[model samples]
Target: MKKSDFRYDLPTELIAQHPLAARSASRLLLLPPAPAPLEDRAVRDLPALLAPGDLLVFNDTRVIPARLFGRKATGGRVEVLVERVLDGNEARAQLGVSKPPAAGSELVLDDGTRVAVLGREGEFYRLRFESDEPLEKLLKRIGRMPLPPYMTREPDAADAERYQTVFARAPGAVAAPTAGLHFDEALLAALRARGVEFGHITLHVGAGTFQPMRAEEFKDHVMHSEWLNVGASLCERIRAAKARGGRVVAVGTTVVRALESSFRDGEVRPFAGDTRLFLFPGKRIRSVDALVTNFHLPESTLLMLVSAFAGYERVMAAYAHAVRERYRFFSYGDAMLVFPEREGGTDATAHDSRLH
Candidate 1:
């Protein structure tokens, strides 16, 4: 499919700048399997929308304070966004400055800590901290929250809490799994009381998630790689849920990607590695029966994934309805509950071939 196929018209004012006061207060748009009417509801209504035996899979990767400000030894100012921590004192990062620094260039942080540019890997630079302290500890002291570029204002103290999900524990992600952000401790307790089962996968969201698709055709695009771990325990839980006629509901796109990446010949197996899975129209998604995700940017890969899960026409129509209803868009925005698309007025069956 062409990249233009996923484009939509969104007003600038609709971009959400701040999170709602209450996490569960955000609106939820329900897109059931095709032919079912869409329902307008709130995040708090999620427990009622689901059944007793349903499984809700979540990405437990936590967001880190990965943005840092520093100066090149040449005296030029530079901003660094750590993409992934490689070791206790080394990381791969993207640098923003007037000019790209050569390999081996030294950078000085505001706190007088120094970092050495070891080398380059594609679009990221390998950086080694010169401190005896681990890089993670240094970030905690001076690094700022890495907010999405679409958010105009600077990250404030409130963002330290609001930008992270309540259940976040495994730390590594530079970006939050926004869909999971809607659930608070109270909401989670409510789901548990309703007999909903919870499963977790860790997919450390990379900064590359925000990169734009530079290719016109979807076939030519190369998806970004993100590290994920799908445990054997979660796979067994998913199988048990399916046996009981319960749905596997993914909390966010990250969960969907991780689960799908672990799926093998009619089974989900344990996996621990990097994945470059890309989902678009025509791909059969066998991992989850329903998806809970935030509104994505127009013409983005994320939008295309949701369109593939739901029908393309249906998703576009829903986006139009959301725009007309003044729904907020982007990272700090509202969410949708989407089910798989049926073909020829019947349920679509999974194909044998794996999708990349």
Candidate 2:
């Protein structure tokens, strides 16, 4: 489909800057198909909206503090945004500077750590540092959390806590599973108290999650890859949930793509690898009954994916309603609960078990 098909007016004012005082306080726009219900409710009212047997599949990928600012040996200012950590003290990153620093050049960080430019690794720069600490530990000490470009402000103390989900564990993502941001400990507890089962999977959301579609046609776009790991235990849990006729609700598009990527011959299996699965209109959804996601930028892949799930007409109409209702949009904004048409390629019964 053409990227233009997803175009809509998103006023700059509607893009949320900071999160609400309470996560669950975010508004929820629920969209079901014809004859189904569409409710404009607060996220805190989730328990009442979902069934007791529903399985909430959450992305546990942790966002890394990948933004780092430093100066070259010649005192030129530079910023290194780590795209992917290769190993201990090794990473492929975007080097922002007045000029491209060449191989064998030295980058002196503000923390006094020296990172040497090994060479170019594809579109990213390969950097090597002399440090005994592991990559994660080194990042914690010297790197800053990479906030989205929209924030208009740098990462502060509050972001270290607010930017992460309560269930975050496996570390790799440059961006957090944003939809999961709406759920706090108290809200999760409430869901569990009402018999909602939680299942965990890993899909490290790379910078790709935020990259816009420059191409008009989605088929012309080359998706950036992100690593994911779906273990057998998670598969078993989802399968069991299906057997009992429960819904598989993905917390975000990342989880949805990861779960669908794990499918084979119309069945889900344990999967661990990088996926560049392009989700647009006409793509068949193997798993994922419902989605909980943040509103996205206009004419982007995210909007297209949600449109595919929620139906193009319904999603566009719902977005118009979201703007009219004054609901916040994007990252720290509000959320949406979308139910895909179950009768076509994706049936509620087809996803009764083994959903990603």
Candidate 3:
């Protein structure tokens, strides 16, 4: 499909600049399996929208403080956003500077730590830290949170906590799996009490997630790679859920990508590697039944994935309704509970069975 097919008109004011005071307080837009009316609800109502025995797969990859400011040995200022940590003291990063630094160039960070440029890797620069301390530890001391470009304000104290999900553990991501951000301890506990099962997969979101597609056609677009780990245990949990006639609900697009990447031979398998899986209209999503995700950017790959899972026209209409209702957009925004499109008309029986 053409990239323009996914475009939508969103007001500048609708892009969420800050997170809501409470995680579970954000609004939820329910897009039932098409040919139905979109319902406006709150994040707290998530437990009720799901049925017992459902498996909610979450991306537990934690966001790291990846943004850093430094100066070249020649005294030119440069900004660094670490894309991925390669080792204890080495990382691949995107540099913002007046001119691209040559290989072997040295940079002095604001904190006085030095980093040596190893070389370039596509759009990223590989650098090795001169400090005896690990790169991750150094980032904890001086790096700032990497907020989305849409937010004009600098990262503050609240962002340190609010930008991360409560269940975040494995730290590597420069961006959060935002759909997981809506669940607090209370809501998780509520879901557990309602007999829902939980599973986790790790997909460290890269800064490339925000990169715009320059290609007009989807076939010409090359997706950025992200590392993911889908364990055998989680695969078994998904199978058990399916066996029990329960839905496999993905918490975010990241989780959806991970699960789908791990799917092989009609079942999910253990996988630990980088994936460049791109989901767009016409691709069958066999790994997940329902999805919980935040509003995405216009003409973005994320939006195309949503349009693929639900019907393209239906998703566009729902997005229009969200705009009319003034639903918040992007990272720190509201969410949606979306079910996959069925072969026939709407699966009202399955929809009603879960909600009622």
Least accurate stretch of 10 residues (summed lDDT) in model 3?
343-352
Local error of candidate 2 at residue 17 (angstroms): 1.0
Question: Would you estimate the TM-scores of all the predictions?
Answer: 0.95, 0.94, 0.97
lDDT of 1 by residue, 1-356 (tens): 79999889999999999999999999999887666677788889998888788899999999999999989999999999999998759999999989998998999998999999999988899999899988888889999999999999999999999999998999999999999999999999999998899999999999999999989988899899999999989999998988876778899999989988998987689999999999888887888888899999988989988988897999999999999998888889999988776742212233111110
The alpha-carbon root-mean-square deviation between model 1 and the true structure, to one decimal in Å, is 4.1
By TM-score, the best candidate is 3
Residue pairs that clash (backbone atoms under 3 angstroms), model 3: none
RMSD of 2: 3.0
Q: Where is model 1 poorest over a 10-residue stretch in terms of lDDT?
A: 347-356
What ranges in model 1 sit over 4 Å off? 343-356
Predicted structure 2: lDDT:
0.84
Question: What are the lDDT scores of the predictions, listed in order?
Answer: 0.89, 0.84, 0.91
